[model samples]
Target: MVVLFLATSFFCVGQAAKDRFKDWAQTPPMGWNSWDCYGPTVQEHEVKANADYMASHLKDYGWDYVVVDIRWFVENTKRHGYNQIDPRYVLDAYGRYMPATNRFPSASDGSGFKALADYVHQKGLKFGIHIMRGIPTEAVKRKLPIKGTDGITADQVYTTENQCKWLKDNYTIVADKPGAQEYYDSIFELYAEWGVDFVKIDDLSAPIYHEDEINLIRKAIDKCGRPIVLSTSPGATPVTAGPHVSEHANMWRMVNDVWDHWRHLDHLIGVSQDWFSYIKPGTWPDCDMIPLGRLSIRGERGDDRMTSLTKDEQYTLMTFFTIFRSPLMFGGDLPSNDDFTLSLLTNKEVLKMHAESSQVRSLYYDEDKTAITSKNENEDWTYLALFNLSDSAPSDVWVNLSDMGMEGPVKISNMWTNEVLGTVKGKFTQNLAPHASGLYKIEKD
Candidate 1:
């Protein structure tokens, strides 16, 4: 896919709904998702515990959301992967997937996620849910009535074309079919009732670019009467469809599931570089989650343990994500975070750069090294990110101050450590450990 570097309008015709809620995510959203630790079987208590952790610790530094990831409606979820074999799904009379009360016990009364959402909201944080993009196949089989429709139903509006292959839960909603928009509208309407603050819709981006359904969902959200942040996932989100997704979704994945490994982190450097131009205030190109702290307790990929990434590499993970201004969704179990991991999330200076910096762009990229730069329009300092892509040996990464729109003597301080690394002129260089990175602020002295 060809990456286009263009600054275009995020809105198109028939986007009256988008115009109102477009400002909901003015900066990259920082939150915690349950998928990294609990897979699909995250219990209501687990969700509340994470929320409690976020509220007590991370909320002051902008980490607010506590999201329940995929398969909340599955009554029997398995670990190490999905419960593809005899997975029991729960659906409401209206055919909307409801939280499996066996898993989310608060929904035993059929309140769905309302009680959990209220629990999260009471913590001064937000709540989000993961959903597959389409109508539940069971809903179609049951021929459930599409809410707010004149006897229209789920089976009438869905199509088998381009249906999600890996997960057999839902059928793709036909863009122009009758009740299609209502199907989406009804779901978001339910989410609004549950007081959902964010929704990450999967199978709607990448390999199959579901722009029409995205529009339907966008319209659904606009009509829901809530400022729900929309996120599209499992990307490499067809680089050419940037503007369309930008208009409809607040955070669309730029790469597939990024694991806690060196290569995965290495791969995102390029994806972020390719998506650099699209980093506007409201629309962010997500680079997946931060698989740090304690991960894979009962996750889809691995056995229970902390992340496999080493300390230096973890810094690169935080450094690049912050400077690139991608949404920081911590994928680990928050309550289990160690002192070192907690330190990564609490640094005010690094997060300030993530939230405030503008004009973010790659200064250069190559096999051995990569450099990225940004500026806060409100401040005089220029922020820079330098990474050593090399795996084994220490390497020197270099960039010219002139390229960063700076010249002459300038004081450079490490944003992570806040240690002044002295002054430099037009040419500057920093030696980084293998797989390590650095964040610095350059200001004219």
Candidate 2:
């Protein structure tokens, strides 16, 4: 039966084919994630600090989620990579890892993340956590019982075959096994009770695609009776699996771990070209986290610093991310944002295009420049993005009005700088610095 279900493709037209969880994030989710700056070592106070900052300054701009990323259950975690210490994790009797109260004191006495989630809820924001794909290795090693199953154990429901090569935290759950589904159900149930609004399942889509496990998780969330938004990540999720992933997940990463480096930024543009066709209202092709503002306070990479991208490149970063319509998971210490970085986050016009635009597509590209175009579905206007990818020299970037579904005598206003360049008849042209970009709104005069 699992085989039959896995073989089914969820492709259909009309109302019923829409994902039930689609409404949970009609537009791509804008939020902060702890991974790029805090890695696996984010403390409760730090999480609360970011939440308070977001609630006060960013919630009105559509930034809502405050996500704790990776290994919140482990103690003595390293700033770079992980510390493989003896008896590293705190776990319950069921072999499921629990938050290390040393870091998240609010999780003490088996309360889990309830107190922290409640704090964020009271401040009018959502809470999310990151988890590895499978059952904890400690659980199987200790032979812990699987909840919601009669006389079934974690060891019985898992295998080591095809496990994550880099992260050795968990073993693969054998979905056909009697208690495997129950194990997934059990974890999500606990998360629901803890008031988790979002979940990012790591190592689920990359290197290898675990369709069975994803299906099991999808069912568990549905059965858990919460409107929990699911995000599957750490990929390059294969385009061949697009149909299944789009139907199953709210967002899936199209690239892995983008950081504050030019190479990483450039690679994102190249990689993102392949994913433009896959974006839809509910299912987003993630561009990973936006590595802006201050980062690496306790990260897996580099020392503490503000983002290295120059002002022009930062414009390029925000321009492509919004015009491409990727879920904006800002990766920085929120309270630490400088004025320029804060400006990037609060651009209402650019964000509006990100949320409401449809038919977004890559128009043309070459060694020096690329053009992207889209339309606002609700207000019925056109949007265009021009990017310069040269090494050092500025270049003139132009887009023909006809190619963007607009004719002559139309206004082309720069959405980022809010400058209207009067009316254009045949074409729009602007010279951009190397690695800079412009986002424009085009409408008939």
Candidate 3:
């Protein structure tokens, strides 16, 4: 009877936590993440540089979150390589990972990420960090005491049987154990104290789909008394689990790490189609980061270079994501953005399609062309994205007004070029370059 009472109380607390922060993430989050450019070795200076760039250039256009992705706790992570085998992760007494002072010097003197997060907040941006979905294996080995759980230790709450296939630094937490929830609670408490605004939990989403750990993390996020947006990573989050994920997380990835490849962009069409109905105001289906501008500077893929995607393909990438209302996280080196990339990222109309439009979905697709459409809630405009998926030739992409449930004689304007394409009745068509797209805004004439 006592155990049942405790379980009920815990459930109530979790519910309360979610209710308190329901207003967060009202729009798809736009931001920059460190992984695509710097991989596991992103340092304080690098993060600050991007934050500085965003504040100066991108902040006005709603690009705000600055996330430092994986392996921030390691001492000397090689460029393009995660230091999973290194037993030198920085951890607090209670077994929570801390930013390595060697990388984030501001975290020195037991301050954790408070100073860096404060700097980001001062610059009018939110701060986020990446974490693997488990207690550190090193902590369990040392039998560290789980904070907030009297006499319970790390090993007691961990199960070695469910380890991450790629990263061996942490052990999956046994959710039913006495100390498991307490440990997650403690880590989030520290994050709250440090003023973290977002957290991306890895190995808990698609492919692995650690639902139990996701719940524990959600509970911890709520109990911490902060409104941190919870994101789950490395997805293809099962379409069947959409409702469960929406209940627990603000955003969940719909595909694996999206990079500068045409095939990657092509795959997103089907992925978006499957997950379109699941998108809501606070919950989003993430398309992963946009790998444009200068990428792989010192990271996993290669040395510094502009995105391999052609200019037209880049537009298609942005068009697809915005129309689908997927969270946009710029994953390139910010300071190195060329005018073309800058224009793409800052186009207010395209951004509005993402932030204000609803009823977004693919209208039509074929062997050569694909078309998607959405309606703006705040305005009478309808957004249309026509893509030429063909590699060898330009293709004519068409959208019928009747299929869109709209009547004849519509005014259409190319969103990218800002050119009015003249009034059209019945249907509108645009010839797009190979591997390119045309985004148009349609209104009744």
Ranking by TM-score: 1, 2, 3
Candidate 2: tens digits of C-alpha lDDT, residues 50-147: 99999999999999999999999997787888876554888888777789999999999999999999999999999999999999999998899999
lDDT of 1 at 250: 91
The C-alpha lDDT values of all candidates are 0.90, 0.90, 0.89
Check candidate 2 and list the clashing pairs. Answer: none
Write one digit per residue (lDDT tens) for candidate 1, span 1-445.
1233222232433354345566899999999999999888799989999999999999999999988999999999988888787888899888999999988888877899999999999999999999999999899988999988899988899889898988989999888988988888899999999999999999988788988888899889988988999999989898899988888789899888999988988888877777988998889999899999898888898899999999998999999889999999999999999999999999999999999999999988987799999998788879998999997899889898889877689999998889999988988888989998889998889
TM-scores for every candidate against the unseen true structure: 0.96, 0.95, 0.95
Off by over 4 Å in 1: 1-17
For each of the candidates, give the backbone clash count.
0, 0, 0
* Model 2 lDDT-worst window of ten: 9-18
lDDT at residue 137 of model 1 (Cα atoms)? 88
Q: How close is candidate 2 to the true structure, as a TM-score?
A: 0.95
Using TM-score as the yardstick, the better of models 1 and 3 is 1
437 Cα displacement, candidate 3 (Å)? 0.5
* Candidate 2 segments whose C-alpha is farther than 4 A from its true place: 1-18
